[model samples]
Target: MFDADWPHRLHSAEQVRALDAQIIAAGTPGFALMQRAAAACWRALRKQFGEVGALTVLAGSGNNAGDGYLIALLAQQAGWQVQLYWLSEPAGLRGDAQLAVQAAQAAGVAMQAFDQQAEANGVLVDALLGTGLSGEVRAPYRAAIEWLNQQTNPCLAVDIPSGLCADSGAVLGAAVQADITVTFIGLKLGLFTGAGPEYVGTLVFADLQAGETAQTAPSVAQVLTSDTVPRLPPRSAACHKGQLGHVLIVGGDLGMGGAVLLAAEAALRLGAGMVSVATRAEHVAPLLARLPEVMVKAMRSAADLQPLLARASVVVLGPGLGQSAWGISLASAVAASDVAQVWDADALNLLAAGTLRAPQAPWLITPHPGEAARLLAISSAAVQAGRPQALARLCGRYPATVLLKGVGSLLAEQGSAVSCCVHGHPAMAGPGLGDVLSGAVAALWAQGLSALEALQLAVWLHARAGEQLGAQGRGLAASDLIAVMRRLLEEHAPCRT
Candidate 1:
C-alpha cells in the first residue's frame, strides 16, 4: 500500500539540485543539510540492519561522498569499526564535502584508498556517484561498483545507487545493487522507472527538512498513488445502464478468443454500464459462455463493426487482434470512429506499421516496451533505456494519452506531468494483462473520466491489484486481476456515494 505522506512529486536530478540550492540560499547552511542527510541515512541504516557493528564506506569526490564520510564518522563515534575507501581523492573535495572529510578526520575514522584487494568489512555504504553523472561511469568507480555487487555483504546506497542515471534510470555502465537505498531531498523520477527498480532494493526517503523548499520547486513527474489519483464520481440513485455509457472491446482472432474475453470481462467488472465484444464469429460462443453480460457480435469485417462502434462511448482496441486482414479492417474502422478509445496489442502494432493513422478521438495507448519501440522506430533496448523520454515522445507524437507498461508503468499526456505507478509485482508478468488494462482504461473513460484520468486510475488499479494478488507467488494469470480491481475500485470509489 502507498503511504499518503510519501511525496507524490518526482523530480529530475537538476531539479533536485536546484531545490537543494534553494534550501541553502534560504538560510540553511549546506554543511548542515549534509549533516542532516547523513543523520537520516544513519538512522535508517540502524533501523534496517540492527546495529551492525562494522561499516565499510566507499567515498568519491562529490557531495555524495560527503554523506559517506559523515556516516563513517557517525559509525566510528558509536565505537563501531569503520573502514572508509576513497575512490576519488579526498584532498580535492570542496565546500560541504571538504568539511565532512575534515570532521571525519577529527573524529579519527580510518580512511584508505579503494583497491580491488580491499575486502568489504561489513555493511557496504555506496556513495561513489550522485545524480550529477551524465555519461558512462569511469575506471576505478566502475571496478568498485562491480566489486560491490560481487560481495555478499549487505549494502546501503546514499542518495541513489552508484551508476544509475537520476534522470533516465539508465545504468551508465554498472550500478550498485544495494539492500537499502536512502534517498534525500526529492524523489528522483529514475528511482521508480526504467532500470532503477532492479538496483534499488528498499527505498527510503528523507527531505533533510527541506519539504517546504521542494514544494515550490518544479518537478518533472508525479507518482500515482491512491491519494494522488482521481476517484470515480458517485452514481445517482436512479442511474440507468444507458446513462453510464457502453464500452466496446474489439479483437480476438481465431485462436486468441481468451484475450478478448478477458478484456470484455474486465470492462464489465470495472463498472462499465454496458459491455460489448466485436470479435471473430468463432469466438462469440466461448465469450458468451464465459461472460454473458457482454453483448457479443461476430465481426466479419469493418462493415460488421459499424453498428457496435456506433453505440459504444469508449472502444478498447486490439486484444489478440492479429495482423490479419480482418483485424486491420476493424482497426481502420475504429480509428475513423469519434468514440474515445484505449489502444493495445495489435492496434498499436498496426499504428507502428503505418497501417492505421493516429486516432483523432480522445484516446489512450497502452504499449509494452516492444510495442513502444515499434511505435518509436527504435530498439526495445532504447525504449527501456530512457522510458521517460520515450513516453514523452510518444505523448508528443500522438494526440492520445500514453501509458508505457513495464516495471514502473508511466502514463503521460501532452500538457501534464508524467505519472508513474510503482505498485506492480514481478509475478504479474504474463499474457492478457495488457488486455485487462485496456478494458480498465475504456471502462473508466466510459464512466466520465477524461482519457488521462482514466489511464491514471486504470494503471494504478491494475498495478495495485497485481501487487495484492502477486504476493501469493508466481503463475499469476491475467484474469486474476479483474475481481481484485473491481474490489479495489469500489473501495476507492463507492457507487452509492
Candidate 2:
C-alpha cells in the first residue's frame, strides 16, 4: 500500500550530501535546509511523545546535533522538562549547527555536558551522529551510544540511527537503537537494508519540499512497493489456456523429489497454463499422487529430459538438485537448454563450482546469502556486510539477472539499477521460500513478462504473501506463500478468471 510518488529512490550518504549541495546551489541556503530538517524532526518527536513527561537530547557537534537543539527548544516552549546533553562543546560548532546552538540558547534552552551517571530518563532524542558515519564508533561517542542503548526509555533518532553506515547499513562499532527514526530529504539506502532495519525501528521520512527535480544524479536503487509491482494487466475474457506459457521443473534427484514438486506446484498455482516435472524415476508416482495436474516424468538421463524441456516455455532448475552424478548430468543438460530459465538452490552451487556453463537462454538466478557468498568466493558475513557490492559483482560475473535474497531482497540486471523489496516478513526466512520464488518467477516469465519483470513481480509477490501469512505467527512454511501469492496476483494483476 505504498504511495506511488513517495520518494522510493534510495540515496547513498555521499549522494545525499551531493543532493543537499545541489539544493543549496539552486537558491535555498544551507541553513534553510538545516532549519527544515530540524522542524521535521521536532514535529515527529512531538507526535511520537505527546504524553511523555521528560525529554533528553543527546547532541553532537555536527548538523545532526543541530537537530537535537531545535527539538529541545520545541520541547521547552511546550513547558516540558528537558535535559540537553552535548557530547562535544557547542561553542566549537561551525556552519548551520553553530546557528542552531545559538538559537536554542537565545530561547533559554540550557545545554549540559555529557555525564554517564546522569538521570537519563524520558524520551531520548539521538542526534549524536548522522548518515556521515562510515566506520566503527570511536571514543566518547561509543560510550554514549552504549549507555543510551542500556536505557529503557523510548528514543527518537534524527535522520538515521547514529553510527549506522548510510550506504551499506553496517553498524559502526555501535549504533543507537531508537524506537522511532525521522529521516529527511533523500532516503538513505542503509535505512532499509543490512543492520539498518534492526536499528531503525519505526521510520518516518520527510522530503522537506526538496521537490521532484533532482539537483544531482539520481540514485542507483529504488524500493519495489505497490507502486513498482511489476505485473500484467487484467486478462481479456477471450484469453485461453494456450495463451499462458508452459513451465517445466528440473531437478529433485533421488530422495529429494519434494523440492522439484514444490517448484512445479508453485508454477501451476501462479497461473502457468501447463506444468511438467523432470526428476528421478521413483519420484513420478508420488508427484502424480500429490499434484496430478503436473505432468510427471522419470528422467534417468539428459535424453529423458529434452522432450519435456523442448515443450516448456520456461525452465525452473535446481531445487533439491544434489551433487551426485545423476544431478550433475541433469544440471549440465538444463544449463544448455534453449528456453528461458530460473536457476536456484543447487543449480547455483553447481554454477559456483564451475561444473556447468551459464544458461544458453536469458536467465535469472535466485541465491540466498550463502549461495551468493559461495558464488562470489567470499564469506556470507561479507555478503551481508555489503549487499549492493555483492550484487554488482554477481551481475558483472554472471550473465543471468540476479536476485540476492535476504532481509531486503535485491534484484538487478546487468545494466539496471538494483531494485530492493522491503515488504517481506521475518517468518519468510524459513525453508522452501527460495524454491517457491524461483517457480513464481519462471511462471511469470513463461506468461510473457521479461526476465527482469518476472523477477521483480515474483520476488514482491512471494515476500508480500509471506508478510500476510506471517501475521498468523511464526510457523510460516515455504508452501504457505503459494496460495497467498496466487490470490494476490489475481487481485493485483489478474489473469482472466
Lowest summed lDDT over 10 consecutive residues: which window, candidate 2? 208-217
lDDT of model 2, residue 60: 88
TM-score of each predicted structure versus truth: 0.98, 0.96
Query: Tens digits of per-residue lDDT for model 1 on 337-452?
Result: 99888899999999999999988888888989999999999999999889999998998988888999898888888988889898999998889998898888888889989888
- Candidate 1 backbone collisions, by pair: none
Which lDDT tens digits does candidate 2 get at residues 145-256? Answer: 9889999998999999888888878788799998999887888888888888889988888887788545335896889886777877667888786789999999888889
RMSD of each: 1.0, 1.9
What number of backbone clashes does candidate 1 have, counting pairs of residues 3 or more apart or in separate chains?
A: 0
* Whole-model lDDT values for every prediction: 0.91, 0.86
lDDT of 2 at 425: 79
The alpha-carbon lDDT assigned to residue 369 of candidate 2 equals 92
* Backbone clashes in model 2, listed as residue pairs: 136-173, 137-173
